[model samples]
Target: MQECLGFYAWQGNWERLFGASFPQTTDQAGVAPLLSRVPVVWFSFDEAGNMTTQNAYANRPKGWEKMVDACRGRGIAVDMTVAYLDGPKLEKILADDSITDRIIAGIEREVALFDGVNIDLEGLGSKSVHQADSRTLVRYNFNRFLNKLRDRLQRLNKRLYVCVHPLNGWFLGYDYREIARLSDGLVVMAYHYGPTPEPYEPVEQSVTLALASGVPQEKLILGILTLKPYEIPETLAEKVGIAQKHRIGGIALWKISFLNEDFQAVLRRLLQIK
Candidate 1:
């Protein structure tokens, strides 16, 4: 089995993630038991690349620090994600040198608590209206920001992971080969594809695009949405299967809260756990 990275989302009002309704999984009692099963946990504690405030400080989940410490103590690689989904704003933020410097410095403070950081900047690339890659300015600024971030993380002995839109999608900002060359790796958010909530064609095409774009198969982590409109157990299982079939780096589940009974059963069977 490849690496299974679970995004532990408890940021802000959980009901509004990606502008969809989901049961508030942050405060659920059942989540305790599932904690031990996760091999790697990506902490999405609500960061928006803000220059005015440290968003993580206000939005972090209760006991999140302890969770990070405990996960690392268990030998699990715990990382954090900072997201900002506005293209215009994100492009502007990246375009400013002093602002980007402050943002990177602020991120360092949060990432020091984990194994690394995942830059979850969306919108910037997805705005090109079904074009090839990100806008040239967006591409240039974003990569430059990554370059500086990569250097900062290197000094802190932390890894940098970037979450990107699927190359097959209309979202444009991602330059996969360029991003792969600049950072440690990438998580392709190939979640909204469907003929039946979780079909396989888009994923196959995405993995194909990333590889053909010169991204190493081993460094590409396939990220998929496991809940919401996921009506059956096979939906989640099939998504994971695509990554395994391609022999990519791993699979990243959108969030862990939806690992309720039905999905847990599916997970156990796929992981071959007793």
Candidate 2:
């Protein structure tokens, strides 16, 4: 079984994944031994890696360059998240044509430093964070934003990948079919199956649903949960095997920052299992 190690660089803490294993200096060569065989995609959280509330992406973080440079030096692929908001602030920003244009321009500017872009516009249709009446507006704005992004990246001949959750009543803002058509690939966030004792959609189930959704299996990247918020007996290796047997384009572990040495070793074993 072959699997790609996905690094979610949340909170500027890539080192957290391996703890002491990460050297004090990212400058050392031949780091990330796990990446030797498979392609790695880095998922930098949008809105400054914050989860409690949506915030505008601020200035580039301090260690951004070293991380990017190190990964590229190792022949790893990288991608960052583009966050969008649907509120008074967003309305104001959109109202100003210059602001919208500048924001898009800024996105293009930032992506130049990496291999691709990952659009992570969460709270699109989630009433828990957004108003119900604004769902349609949010949906429209989200798609329009993606269209503009796709168009811009097309001009540069770059890839645009989207990471979105499974279609739920709470997040109807995203239409997977159209999204799949517009972007180079779709990363179905198969986890976050909240509260269900047995996850509503396990790894195998997510693969089945993704294939049935008209997303070319090869273009669909499975988001495997490296850290479970809840207790689940199965190990990460088991899930990797399931995904490998299904033969997805690849499986992207939800994060690098959350894995321990044991977890990473498991990841390495899984990657070489075939």
Candidate whose lDDT is highest? 1
Q: Which residue pairs collide, candidate 1?
A: 125-172, 125-173, 126-171, 126-172
Q: Per-residue CA lDDT of candidate 2, range 122-177, in tens?
A: 54566566665676666566567678878999988777778776654345566676
Clashes of each: 4, 2
By summed lDDT, which 10 consecutive residues of candidate 2 come out lowest? 44-53
**Cα lDDT, model 1, residue 226:** 68
Model 1 Cα lDDT, one tens digit per residue, 32-97: 323322322332222244432234322355555565655555556777777666666677778888
lDDT of each: 0.67, 0.58
